[model samples]
Target: MDIQEKARPPAEVYDAQFVPALFAQWGQVVCAEASVREGDRILDVACGTGALTLAAADIAGPSGSVVGLDVNPEMLAVARRKPAQIEWLEGAAEALPFPDNSFDAVVSQFGFMFFEDKPKALAEMMRVLKPKGGLAVAVCDAVENSPGYGAFALLLDRLFGKEAGNAFRAPFSLGEAGQLTAICREAGLSHAEVVRRNGKVRFKSIDALVSTERACAWTLGGVLNDEQFERLLNESLSVLEPFTVDSGAVEFGMASLIIKARKV
Candidate 1:
């Protein structure tokens, strides 16, 4: 598999089973911060498979409207197969296709990492929010904060060695709380709160983990050519062989960051 094409595994893997569960996991926290009320319009940026969009629909009720936006057609296809209660639009976070101050709230789950330009995306998120509207973007902290990922990453490094394995950069400025605060401030967000949600999702086995790696292609960023990709894949699989038990079912937990703010 071309690793760069599928770098964000969480988006693709969770497009099925995990997306809804992740929504259910953070539903209340997001709703509480979003301050959703009847008749309020909401926007879910990079809505992925529409988990947060559906969650926003639940909170917005029939009176409020929820618009889900995503740039990935494959992911959007999975989202479209769901019920048609939500308005799913094709768009990018860096350039939202909505009027200024159009939404009472804007929410994104685990999407900031994929953004090529975070400040530009944040500014767009701010622009879409109505005056005083809330914005909540959830992202996972560094691998160190997430135990399952740390172990998974360690295994990758051991198998691929430091040179080839360090392709994973946690993808965002998540480890720097101060940096996040400053970004929010620059984006014209006020009353911001950086909350840590220490949570974990258990995989049935190591094969499941491998499946996730294959589908998402986390580490091989363009640096790994076809030969290196095959070698790394074989080496990683060999390393994971011992961890496979009871048909390769294993449990792994993740710690995530839930940053909430209000557009000034």
Candidate 2:
């Protein structure tokens, strides 16, 4: 079956399933890189379900201010329910709602790759940062560098087609260090550097990994029919077994890049 455009995944499922397993840990990493301090004003663009935004708020503390913005109202709804007292706004990265020079630090984790206009979004991020403000943006490393996913992507191609394969591969669009650094420079950000870091991806089981992808529009959500989904799930058992530990959880090493810069 061919991949079809679909509504973004259900935010509740995203928040409940993938957030803890995949995105939560990176929150602190991005916040630390952005140098979020006790009283800094921070912004999290494309703050899906507020995983990274929550981390930023903790670092920023009660005295500090943090805002989480996303285009999806569903995601923002989930984010707004989080316990932290931070601002949750419905917005897009390409056009930030606040005034220019609005934040002491800006951090986005694993979110930039999906922007409709990457250049415009990056410029918008730069526009909102105060001079010398920290900028830390994270994206998945290239498919080639992420072996488990790389193999899974190819399997998708075999089972579905290039379109399905690409759907799975889409998240790593900003993987190259040089390319990311160049993009930052082109956006007029200063001292931009892209550092690749290793991370672990853990799913409670092989089924969990397959199911999570099925729930996410960025990956396989609308792409797989029930039969296709079952086929992929069944096929993935043996394919993903190498990464599965004795406890039946799937674990693999993934890489991510953090593009750090200053707005000076």
TM-score of each: 0.80, 0.94
**Could you tell me the TM-score of candidate 2?**
0.94
User: Can you write out model 1's per-residue Cα lDDT over 1-264, one digit (the tens) per residue?
Assistant: 444434554555656435533344665566567686677798888888887788788878888998889988777878888885888889889999988989999888777877777778888988889988988887767776655556656766776666544555454246557767777776665567888776555556544444444555434344555565565556555564544446655544566677787766
What are the lDDT figures for the candidates, one per model?
A: 0.69, 0.86
Point to the candidate with the largest TM-score: 2
Report how far residue 162 has shifted in candidate 1, in Å.
3.3
Best by lDDT: 2
Regions of model 1 farther than 4 Å from truth: 1-13, 17-24, 168-173, 217-248
**What is the lDDT, from 0 to 100, of the residue 227 in candidate 2?**
88
